[model samples]
Every structure is written in C-alpha cells, then in structure tokens.
Target chain A: MLRLSNLHKRFGQVVALGGLSLHIPAGCIFGLLGPNGAGKTTTISIAVGLLAPDSGEVDLGHGGTPERAEVRRRIGVAPQAIALYDDLTARENLDFFARLYGLSGPQRRERADALLARVGLSDRADHRVKGFSGGMKRRLNLAAALLHDPPIVLLDEPTAGVDPQSRNAILEMARSLRDEGRTVVYTTHYMEEAQRLCDRVAIIDRGRVLAEGTVEQLVGTLGGSSVVTIQTDEGDTRIETADPVGELGRRLAAPGVRGVRVERPDLEAVFLHLTGRSLRD
Target chain B: MNAVLAIAIKDIRLLLRDRMGFFFSFFFPLLIAVFFGVVFRGGGGGGGAGSGIPVAVVDLDNTAESAAFAAKLIAASELEVTTGLSPTEAEEAVRIGRLRGSIVLLPGFGEARRRPFWGEPMSIELAVDPSRAALASMLEGVVTRHAFEGLSEMFADPAKMRGQVRESMDQMRRDGSLPRAMRPAFEMFFNALDSMLQTVQEDSAGEPGEAADPAQAAARAGGWQPVRVSTRAVSARPSGLPTNSFALTFPQGVIWGMMGCALGFAITLVMERTRGTLLRLRIAPLSRMQILAGKAVGCFMVTASVAATLMVIARVVFQVQPTSVIMLAAAIACSSACFVGIMMLLAAVSRTEAAGNGLGWGVLLLMAMIGGGMVPLEFMPGFIRTLSVVSPIRWSLLALEGGVFRGFSMAQMAAPCGVLLGIGGMSFAVGARLFRPD
Candidate 1:
C-alpha cells in the first residue's frame, strides 16, 4: 500500500498540489486521471522523491522509506518522456541501467536480452534509439523501467504519443504487471485506458481529486444518462437544440435508420456531467 | 574501478554517437593545435633557444676595414649578411621581412675612430626593425664582433714590430753608451714613445665604434658584455616554450578542456531534470546521489582522460615533457574534481539545459582568460595579473606547469594543489546543499 497524506506543493504563486491525499492498495493497477496541468506529474514526483511536498508525507507500502534509497530500489518508473539514451542501442541502454541497479555482468546481459525480447525489440536491440519510432522508443522505455524487477511501479503517461497498437500493448503490459502482484500507479488523461486497465480510478483536476471509484460506480453515482449518436454527411455536426435526446430518439425511430443502440453514460459522459468538462479537456 | 570504467565507456559511446558533437570535440582542438604550432614555428621567437636572424649591411667604409668585416659576417653561419646596401635600402629590406635587421656603417666610420668626437665617446647607429626589436641588441653584438675580429688581425703585425724596439733599448743600456742624467731624459722620451705606440697599436685593434682596444669591451659596456645573459634555470624552471609566462599559461588549456567536458554533462543533467528523467530515475530506486554520482564519475573520467591525452601529445609530439609525473597527475586529478563539482553546482542551480550550458560556458571562458589561458601572466597588464590569483585556472596552471617545468618543489607546490582541492571541496558542498530530491 502507498499512502499520501495532505500533500501540498507550490511553484511560485501556482499551487501544483493543494493538500492532496491518496492511498493505493498493493498489487493493483491504479489509474490517476487528470486533465493537462492537473498536478498528476507533481504528485508522482513527490511519491518518487524527486520533489519535496511542502506539507505532507508519502508512505510506500511494505515498510517503504520515503525519499530514501531503499524505497527507490524497490520501485520501477516509466516517465512520460523517452527517457532512454538516444545515442545508445536498446540493449546497451538497458544493460547500463541494469548495472546501475547492481546487476552483475552476466545478469545484466541476460536481463537486457530478455527485456528486449519482451518488448518485441530483440531484432533491433543493437540499433541506436535515435532511429526508433515514437512507439518503439516508448516500448523500450517501459522495458528499461522494468529492468530491476521492482515490486512497485509508477508510470506517468507512459503511453502518450504512442500509436494505438503500442498503447494497447503497453496497457496490456500494465495489466500483466498488476496480475503479477506489483503495485502499479499509472497517470494518464486517457479515460478509455483507465477503464480498460485499472481496477480503480481517481480523476483529478486543478490539483484536487474530483472523483474516485470503479467505472459503473462512478457512472451510477453521477446519475447516468443515456446517449444517442448519429452520423451524417453534413459538416455541421452540432446538436442544434440544447436537449437533443428526444430529437435523437425520434430520428432513430424514423424509416431508413440502419442502426439504433441506446448507450448508458460511459466514462466520458460521466466525466462531463460530474466535472462540467470533457475528458479530453 | 568497474563503476568508473562503465561510466567512461558510456560517455565515449554517447559522444561518439553524436556526429556533430564528435566532429567538434576532436576537430576543434586539433585545428587550434595545428594552427598555433605552425605560427609558433614560423615566428622563430618560439624556438626558445636561438634566433634565425638575417641581417643586411650598408658598408660605406669599404676600405678593407668594412669589406673585411662584411666578409667575416658572410663566413659565419648565423648571419646572412648582404653588402653594398644603402642605408634606406637596408632598412626597407628589414621592414619588408626580407631581413631580420640591418647595420649601416656611416661614411668615414674608420676615419672618425682615429679622431675621437670632442674627446668623447661615440656609438654607431644600427638601424633596425622595431618589430624585431628583441634582436636589435643582438645585431649590435654580431656587427661589433665581426668588426673587432678584422681589427685584431690588422694589429697582429704591429704587436710583433714592437719586439725590435725593445731589443735595441736593451742593447744600448747594457753597453753603457748613455750618461745617467741623459738616460733620465732618454727614459722620459722612451716613456712618451711607449705611450704613443700603445695608443696607435690599440687603435689598430677594432673596437668597432670605440677608439680603443676590443679588450676594453667590458669597461665600455658598464661592467657587462654584449654577450647574452644565458640562463639555466634552477628553481625558476625553464619551459620548452619561451619565458616562464608560458609555464603559467599552458595548463589552462587543459582546464578549459575539462570545463567543456564538465559543461557537457551538466547540460545533459539539466535536460534530464526538465524532461522528468530524473524523476523517473528517482522512482526506479536510484537515489538523487546515485544519479548525481553516476554523472559526476562519468564527467571526471572523461575530463581526466582528455587532460592525460593532451599531456602525452605535448610530450611526444611537441617534446614538452613533464618534470614530474606524480605532480602532473595530482594537478589533473584536482582539476578533474573541481570540474565535476562545478558541473554539479550548475546542474543544481539551473532549471533548464540551455541555461546551465550558457552559464557554464561563460564561467569557463572567464576563468580561462583570468587564469592565464588567453594571455600569459608575464604578458598581462598589472591589474589583470592581480585578478588572476583568485581564478581556479590560476591554481591549476601553477600546479600543473610547476610540475611540468620543475618550477616548484613538492613543498612549494603543496599550496597550489591545496587551493585547487579546496575549490573542489567547496563547490561539491555547495552543489550538494542545492541538490533536492522530492
């Protein structure tokens, strides 16, 4: 279990984290969802000891020492940036980090080879990262973060800028990590990703958590509404009327309507209704 | 050792992979080295031992005196002397770089020597290029020596003719042909004759511009000779380069190079901080110190290698050998530590890579200039020399060049090394204080 209590952080006049708190149960894929500039990064930085919160404490589970070397030794982190050395080969970069983690020569080589294979980059192991595409770099980034086999993992928008296929693979990897009993704290703006991969989700905005729970629970709590959508050739796709649910239903009932499916409010609609903003925003 | 080796290999690999950076690092230093090497070679002043001087002579006194003097110059290997040059032509040739300098003998130069100017001493005007002014006095000596040698040859026969007078005086005195009172008058006449003969005979020996014997050169020069002050340094060690000024300057090149390497890493570290890689590393069980230490070790190894490589090239390629290997190594180690500390401080203080690198370059250039990298202390204006004492480069240069030139004994060198070590320790402490991990 990882617990943050009343964490407060500031930069100049801007309050990046305003008395925020959270608890992550062990061995679960926990999603931290927020809009851009939503203190997701600030909170993660504090958790990992890269930043010092003005007034709060981060307690890593299993006797984790906050801001201590031992705590860092037990955790793997995949940052949003392409953190691997651009000039080094995938295997070389991995081995370098592995050695930093105190792995022996033979062990580092073996682990680097295994991780490259796991990331589907074994064939390109020797190619410098400069030649890698956004997706490949992200995959390698993930592999590097996992080099030490840390029991706890933190990923800050690890799938950002990645293709849909790579995103799927990465999300699946997170699931696998959770299944293998590693406590995972993942940050993203992608509601669909949180829905697909996380057991629990916390939607944060303006340095505060706005909502927290499972998908159905949150939808139900927000008084889930039904949504009707239609496709047309017209470029003007706006619903003219303020309440288009009735109009949408009547149109769906008309002749020549090929498909009609009533949709209970998904995470996107729930987010809009609860927070008065779209998930993407 | 393994950790240090890993870091060094990583640095080399990264630098090699960056095509533009690789080109700049290797080619830039090499280009500067080659350029300076050629210029110093051509300058002749940089030879540090003797001059390759070529002089033109305007011999107006062609009366065997000047002609024989000119011929003597032609015979000697050092001077490439030309004859029959007018005063203006000789000076013009020297100005145009065709000649290092020139000597113009005024008309009636030998005749003037016979009649002393107002019973006072006079000197010949040796027209010279002020650009090669360091060689002016030397040119004067060369001409004086040549003219004196010719005069010595002329006086050789006169000195031999004096022996006949001495023999006649001895025979007259032994036969008792002169009265004692008459002998006194005769002795006075002999004294007068003796004095006149000494004058004429000495005048025959070329004192060049002086109307006296060449043997009086020491007295004429005010107790010093026209000869060079040859110095074989004992404590103030002589470098391969001219002057001890270079001894205070050359080490700063290594310092600047180390600074460059350190700045490279600091910039990289700042970039990592901005991009959240540092945060990622933190989360991955790598403490702030580990990240910092890894980078520091990498930079230190890189800087030390560059410094050592330069020293080797200076020794083998330029024949600039270090007097003490241990001292050189100590200086390099201290400098490397200082570089690492400064880099860490820059990284800690900066919010972005550009700012860090910009700050680093500015500091490095400032230190280089003040520490005797741009201009040697011997050549610097007085105020600048006073200002250089505080620069880390100054201490580095003192320690390193002192080691190379044998300018300081171990006890004497301790203070410079201590100052360098102090700088390193202070910077490291400040950097650590500034370093913050959440």
Candidate 2:
C-alpha cells in the first residue's frame, strides 16, 4: 500500500502538485487517469522519492518512507519513457536492474532469462535495445520493472506506443500482477483501459482528483444523462433523461417515429462528465 | 553484489560499446603516448643498459686528461657511451638517425683542458641534425656540465695540477718570440702560481697512495696547442641521466587517457539522466549518493585500468621499467580518483547528452593544454607552468613521472599525491551536492 498526503510541489512558476493526496489500496489495479500536466508524473516522482515535495509525505507502509532503501525495495516503477540502456542487450539491462535490487549472480541470470521469455523476448534476449522496435522496447521496459518482482508496481503509460498485441500482453501482465495480490498503480490516457482493467479509477484534472470510484459507480453517479433516440421519416430525434425507457416509449408513440433506441452512459461518459471534454495538450 | 558496483559495471559495459568513448578512453591515449615517444626518441640507438640516450664518443686526444674526460663521459648514466668510432663515422650516425648525436674529441682536446687561466677552451665537434634544436641545446648543456665535472677532477688532483702548471711556466719561459721588456711581469705571475702549487703539493706529501708522481702525470699530459679543434660542428656528450622515452611519454599518455575516461563516463551519466535510466535507478533500492558513487567508481576503475594497461605495454613493448611499482600504483590511484571527481562534476553540470559531450571534451582539452599535457613541463613557458599548478592533469602527470622515472622517494611523492587526493575529495563532494538523479 502507498499513501501520499498533502503533497505540494512547484517548478518555478508552475505548480505541479497542489495539496494533492491519494491512498492506493492493496491487491488491485488502481488506475490514475489524468490529462497532460495534471501532476501525474510529479506524483509518481514523489512516490518513488526521485523528487521531494515542498511540504508533504509519501508513506510506503511499515512506518518507513520510500526514501529509505528497505522501504523502496518493495516498490517498482516503469517510467512513461522507455528507460533502458541502448547499447546494452535486453538480458543485460534486466540483469543490471536485477543486480541493483541485490539479486545474486545466478538468481539475476535466471530471473532475467525468465522475464525475457515472459515478455516474448527470449529470442532477442542478447540483442541491443538500440535496434529494438517500439513495441519490443515497451515490452522490455515492462520486463525491467518486473525484474526484482517487488510488491508494489507503478506503471506509467506502460503501453503508450505499443501495437495492439503488445498492449494486450502488457494489460495481461498487469492483470496477473493484480491476481498475485500485488498493488498496481497504473497511469494511462486510454479510458477503455481503465474501464476494463482497473478495479478502482481516479480521474484527475488540474492536479486534483475530480472523481474516484469503481467503473459502475462512477458511470452511474456521474453519468448525468442517457440518450433516447427515435428514428423517424424526416430524421432521428434525440432526448436526454434519467429514465431512457419511458422517454423512448413516449417518443415512439408518434407516427413519424419509426423505431426507438435507448442508450445508457458508460465510463467514457462519466470521464468526460467529470473532466470536461477538452484537449489537455 | 553491491548496488554501487553493479551500476558501475553497467556503466563500464555501456561505455565500452560506444566507439567514440572507447577510442578516447583507450586507443587515442595510447596513440598519443606512442607517437610522442617515437618522435622524441629520434636517433637514439640501442646499447648501454638500454636506458640512456645513445651516443658515440670519438676520443681523438689520447692524453691522460682526455682519457679521464672520456672515462667521465662513459660513467654518465645519462649518456649510453659507445667507444672506437672515427669522427666521420660518428657524424654519419647522427645524419642517418642511427644515433642521437656524436661527440668528437679533436686532436687538441688534451691541451684544450683548461688549466688555471690559460688552456684551449676544451673544444670538441658536436654532430647532430640541426632540425633537432631542442635536443641540440640539451646536448650542449650536457657537454658543458660534464666538461666542468672533468675540470673539477683535474683541480682535485694536486699532481695533475702541479704538473700542468709547471709545464705551462716552462713553455712560457722557452718562448723566444716573447719581448724581453714584458718577461718580468709574466715571470712574476708564473712564480706566484708555482708557489701556490708547491704549497698544495706539500700538504698531501705524507699520503702515500693519495699522491701520484708529478713526472708520470705530466708526461702523459699531451703537448699544448692554441684554443681550437678542426671540425664542422662542436659537441661534448653529457652525463648522469636516463633517456627512456616511454618513461616521460607514458605518463603524459596516461593523462590523456584519464581525460578520455572522464569525458566518456561524464557523457554516459548525462545520457542516463536524459534517456530515463536515471529514473529507474532512482526508484531502485539505492540512494542518490550510491548512484553517483557508482559512476565515480566506474570512471576511477576505468581510468586506472587505462593507465596500468599503457604502463604494462610500455614495459613490454618499449622495455620501459618503473622506478617503483608501489609508487606507480599510488600515482594510478591518485590520478584516477582525481579524474573520477572531474567526471562527476562534468556529469553534474551537463544536463543533456550534447552538452555533456561538447563541454566534457572542451574542459579536458583546455586542461590538457594548460596543464603540460600538450607540452612537457620543461618546455612550457613560465606563466603556463605557474598556472598549471591548478590543473589536475599537471599533478597527475607529475605523480606518474615521479613513479616511473624520477626515482622519487615517499617524501617527494607526497606533494602531487596529496594535491590529487584533495582535489578528488573536494570535487566529489561538490559534484554530489550539485548532482540531480533525474
């Protein structure tokens, strides 16, 4: 479990984090959905102790901060950027990261080989990262984060530039991590990814959490309205109401209304409702 | 298994794969050392302990004094003396680049041995290629120094001095060409010199073996002639120094090698930060200090490795030997530490790969120029040498030279090593303070 309390951070004229706080639960995929420049990276940086907040605390259970080596060993982070040595082979990269976590020589070799196979990269294990394709690199990046097999895994845009197959593989890996009772804090721009993969989703905007709940709870509570469309000879009529079935029934009584269709809101609707439909970038 | 060493090993592996980094860190430095070694070692032939500057001595004057002077030249550890060469042969050796230079002791060299006030000015023909003006000048000084050393020996032997003085007086008295009007002033000076010689001769009269008979020494003293020797060039071989080119150039090469290591590793550090590797490293179970120490240790190990490799190669290929292996190791350790600190500072200051590459080389090249890496300390101008005290490269080179050839005792070794350690400690301290993992 990880807790960030009243984290306030600044970068000169920009406020990256403003009294932001979050409590990620154990043994589940927790999705942090935020637009660009919405304090996502800053929060991750603080959680990993790479950047210290001006005034706040990042508590990684057991009465210790992530700044402590013992506490930090329990956490793992795969950055949004493909963090790997270009000149080093995939296996070498894994071996190096594994060793940094104090894995012995034999253990590191075994773990690196196993992770390379798990990521579907055993065939190209000895190939340098410089020649790797974007999808392969993304997979290798995920493998690196899993090398030490820490309890808490934070994946930031893990499948950002990967193909569909690689994306599915990464999503499956995240699911497996959750199944193993490991907390997964995942950040991504894909709404469907959060809706389908995450047990609890937090939609953040402007460095603050706008909404946080399960997919059904958020969609139902923050859905606002459902649309009832009636197709007629002239055109199609659209209506927004809490009870789409009754609205569609009344609209269908009209002679010009040939057929009626009722639509229910989904997670995307709830996301758009909470954080306005505007491009952050 | 330590995290720091793991990161250090990873960094070394990454640097080794980079072509530019590999060239600078190893090959380029070796090229520099070998290039300068061969160039400065021009015309030195093989012989005489294989350690001194090679030269041929044509001893034309067969007198005891000339023989004594020739013996002195051979005794010099600096000049690898070769005997039994004609003046023409010695001259040809220098012309063909088979020898550094030659010293031709002409016919009048025995008479030219300077006695009290009057004797030929010890003229000898020195043969060397004119283009090698620095070596020419160095040879000239060497000859002058040894000539004086021989003169001191001549002065110390009372029998030789008394014999030469008595012979000069007799020669003066027998010259009928001298005008009778000026004979008394000349005779009075000669008488005074003779009186002084007699008194000195009497003082050592009781020491049996210490004194040589004046007649035997004076008989061997060759006939006097005017102050001149007939030859195209003038030379006198010098004494008491070693001339192994590797001894000098290898240390300089190691300096360049260390710079390469610093720049190479510095750029690697910047690359790690920019490429997001630092992010992963930061999130690992390691402190920021651990990461930096990892980089410093990597650079230090690589720098020391480069130095040791070059020295070993010099020992193997060039037959150059260090005066003290322990001292050389100390030099390697101190210089490596110094540059590792420089690497840290370079990494900390450079935010991007481009900046790291450009700025790292820029700083090192500039340091090399001012620190006597581009030129030796002996050849550097006064101001540059004065300013070089601040350059870590200068101290590193000094420490290495002390170990390799200067035969520096521990007390002599302490200054450069101390400065290097101090510089290393301070640089690492400040660099760590300024370093940002991301």
Residue pairs that clash (backbone atoms under 3 angstroms), model 1: A49-B438, A50-B438, A51-B438, A52-B438, A72-B285, A73-B285
Q: Fraction of true inter-chain Cα contacts (below 8 Å) kept per model?
A: 0.48, 0.94
Off by over 4 Å in 1: A227-259, B1-9, B19-27, B30-34, B42-252, B435-438
What is the Å distance of residue B433 in model 1 from its true position?
Answer: 2.6
How many angstroms is residue B225 displaced in model 1 relative to the true structure, after the best TM-score fit?
A: 7.0
lDDT by residue for model 1 (A1-281), tens? 88888899999999999988898888898889888898998988788777889998888876665577777877788877777788888888898778667789898988899888888899999998889999999999999888889888888898999898888888888988999999999999988888788888888887888788877677667635555555444322333433456868677665555554445666777678767988787
Tens digit of per-residue lDDT, candidate 1, span B272-383: 6676555555655454566677777887887788778767766676655566778788888888888888878877787776788678788878987987665544334446
Deviation in angstroms for B352 in model 2? 1.6
lDDT of 2 at B209: 62
- Superposed on all Cα atoms, the candidates' RMSDs to the truth, in angstroms, are 14.1, 11.7
Q: Which lDDT values do the candidates have, in the order given?
A: 0.68, 0.79
User: The CA-based lDDT of model 1 is what?
Assistant: 0.68
The DockQ value obtained for model 2 is 0.69
Q: How well does each candidate superpose onto the true structure, as a TM-score?
A: 0.71, 0.75
Candidate 2 clash pair list = B78-B241, B125-B235, B126-B234, B126-B235
